[model samples]
Target: MNDLVERFEVAFNQIHQHLKEFNGYPKNDNFVELLQRSKLKHSVIRVHFDLLKQYAKLRNALVHERIRDDYYIATPHLEVVESLEHIKQTLDQPPEALEFATHPVIFFKDTSLLTEIMTAFDQQGVSQFPIYSKDNEFLGLLTNDGIVRWIARSVDNNVVNLAGVTAKDVLQDGLNPSIEFLSSHGTVYELEERFERSLEEERKLKAVILTESGKANDAPLGIVTTWDLIKVDRRNEDE
Candidate 1:
C-alpha cells in the first residue's frame, strides 16, 4: 500500500511539475488550477484533463488525510499508479505529428495539365495534390472533389477537353482550398485539436499542411486531413 501510494504521488508530482514548467505557471498555484490553465495551450493536457482532475482529488486525500507518516489513508491501486506514470511519460515526450502524416507530399505546378494529375491519381491513388506556381509558391489544392466539379462543368455536349485545362483551372471550379499549417515539430495531439477546432468554427479545413515553420509561405513538408485524424484516434485507442 505504501509503495503504491509513493508511485502514484511520484507520477502525479512529475506531471504537475512538467505542466508548471512548460507553461510557466506559478509554483504557488494548485495542480487543478495549473491543469485548467495549461489545457488551453496543450492538447495533451486538454485530452487528459478529467483524469488528471480525479487524480488531483485522490492526491489531496492521500497527502492531507494521512493516518501516519508510513501509512496513507488512501492507498492508490497499482493500475492507477501505472496509468498516471504513462500519462507523465507521454507528456515528457509526446508523439510528433509527422510520424503519422503523409510525407514526401506529391505536389504539382499550377500550370501542370489536368491529364497529368488524372494519370497520377490513377497510378498513385492520390486524391489531392498541392498546386504550386513556377516559383514554388503554393497556389491551391487540386482535389478529387474539385476535379469532379470541373468535369461536371466542362462537359460541353458530353465532351470534356482535358488537354487545355490546368491544375489551377480545376481549383477554380468548386473545392475549398482552405488549409491550416502546422509546424514540423507539432505533436499528434495538437494536430487532432486543430482539426476539431476547424470543425467547431464551421469552416471546411481542406487539410493541414506541415511546413518547416508553420507558415503558409514555407514549403510544405507533409499533409494531414480528416482521414489522418481518424488514424490518430485509432492509434490512440490501440495504445
Candidate 2:
C-alpha cells in the first residue's frame, strides 16, 4: 500500500465530492466533465483548471491500472499528493475577504475639507479613502493619485487655493479613481478575480470596499487594496 497513492486518492475523492455538490450532483457527467463545468463558475476551479485536468487523468490511471488491492503499477509523488490536498482545503474553506482587509475603514464625506483628508492620509498611511455624500451614500473613492493630480493642476494654473477645496472637488480634479464593493462574506478569491477582471477590461481597480451586502448604500466594513493583495501573494509564496 503506497502512502502517497492513498493520500492522493483521499484528496481526489474529497475534491470530486465537493465539485459534484457544487454542480448539484449531475449523474450523467463524469469527474472531468464536472470539473470543466465547475471551472466556469468557481474561481478556484478556474485558476487550477489545467492542473486539475491532469490530476483527473492521473487519478484514473491510478485506479484502473492497480494490479491488486495491495499492489499498484503507479505511485503518486509526495508533492502531487500535497498539492491535491491543498486544493481540496482551499475549496472547502477559503480565506474570507475581511480577514485580510483593513478594518475600521477610514472614509471621508464629499464635503470633507482637504486638510482633514490630508490628515487622514498622513495619520492612517492609507492611499485610498471611500467618499460618501452627506446622506451617507457612497460617491467615489478618493486616492492619493487623485490628490496629486489635483495639486498638479492647481500648481500648473497657479491656483493654489487649497483651503476651500473639498473631497468631492478633489475627486473631480483627480484622475478617476476606480473601486468596487464586496460583501462582508466575500472570499479572497473573489477579490482577486475582481481585480483581474478590471485589468482585463483596461480599467485598473483602486480598491474594493467591503460592505454588509456588497452595495454602495451599505456602510463599509473593511477595505482591500492592491497592496493588500500583494501582501497576500507574498504570504502564500512564503507558505
Candidate 3:
C-alpha cells in the first residue's frame, strides 16, 4: 500500500509539472483547477481531463485519510496507476503528428496561371494545392486530377490559350476537392480518427491542413496526408 501510494503521487506530480510547463505557469496551484482551466483553452487537454480529475480525487483520499495500516485502507490498483501513467505519457510526448506534418505548404491564388501551378507541382512534387480567393479566403483544394480533367476538356474544345487558364476556371468547371482543417496542437490519434471518418464516409480527403486556430483563412502551419500517418506508424514500429 505504501509503495502504491508513492507511485501514484509520483505519477500525479509528473503530470502536474508538465501542465505547469505547458501552460507557462498558471496562477492556480490546484491540479483539478489547473486542468479545468487548461481544458477551457485546449481541446487536447479536455479529452482526458475527466479521467485525470477522478485520479486526482483518488490521490487525495489516499493521502489525507489514515485507516488501519494492516488493512491497507487505500490500495491503489495497478490498472488505475497505469492509466494515470498513460495520461502522463500522452501529455509528456504528444503524438508527433504536427511535428511530422509537411510544412511551408505550397498554396496558390485562385487566379494563378496554369503554367505557374504546373511549375509548382513539378518543382515540389506536390499534387494538391490549397487555393484562395482574391480576398485571401480559402476556396478549396486544387488536385492533379482536376488539372488533368481541365486540360483534357480544353484540348477537346480546341482551346489554345492554356496559359490564360486559371485555378478559378477549373473550379468553375465543377472540380470537387476535399479538405479537412485541424488545429496545430492536434494529436496523431485525432488525425487518424479524421482519416477514418473520411474513409467511412467514402469521401476522398485530399489533405489535412493545420493552422493556428484551425481556420481556413489562416496561413497553414503544416499539412498531413494519409501517407504521413502511415509513415509515422512505421517509424514508431521501428523504434
What digit string (tens of lDDT, one per residue) describes model 1 on residues 14-85?
998887875566856778888987776565677678989999999999999998899777788888999899
What are the C-alpha RMSDs, in order, of all predicted structures? Answer: 3.8, 4.4, 8.5
| RMSD from true fold, candidate 3 | 8.5
lDDT of 2 by residue, 1-239 (tens): 38888899999999999888877789856888998877655567776778889998888889999889888877888888888899899878878889879999888899999889988899988788888998999988888878887788788467677778899898776466788999989987677778877877999888899998999879999999878876665554454
The window of 10 residues in a row where model 3 has the poorest summed lDDT is 230-239
Task: Report the error of model 2 at residue 30, Å.
Answer: 11
Please write out the lDDT profile of model 3 over residues 141-162, one tens digit for every residue: 8888898887887784576567
Order of the predicted models by TM-score, top scorer first:
1, 2, 3
TM-score of 2: 0.76
What is the model-wide C-alpha lDDT for candidate 3? 0.77
TM-score per prediction, in order, is 0.79, 0.76, 0.62
Best by TM-score: 1
Candidate 3: residue 8 Cα off by (Å): 11
Each prediction's total of clashing residue pairs, residues at least 3 apart in sequence or on different chains, is: 0, 0, 0
For model 3 the TM-score comes to 0.62
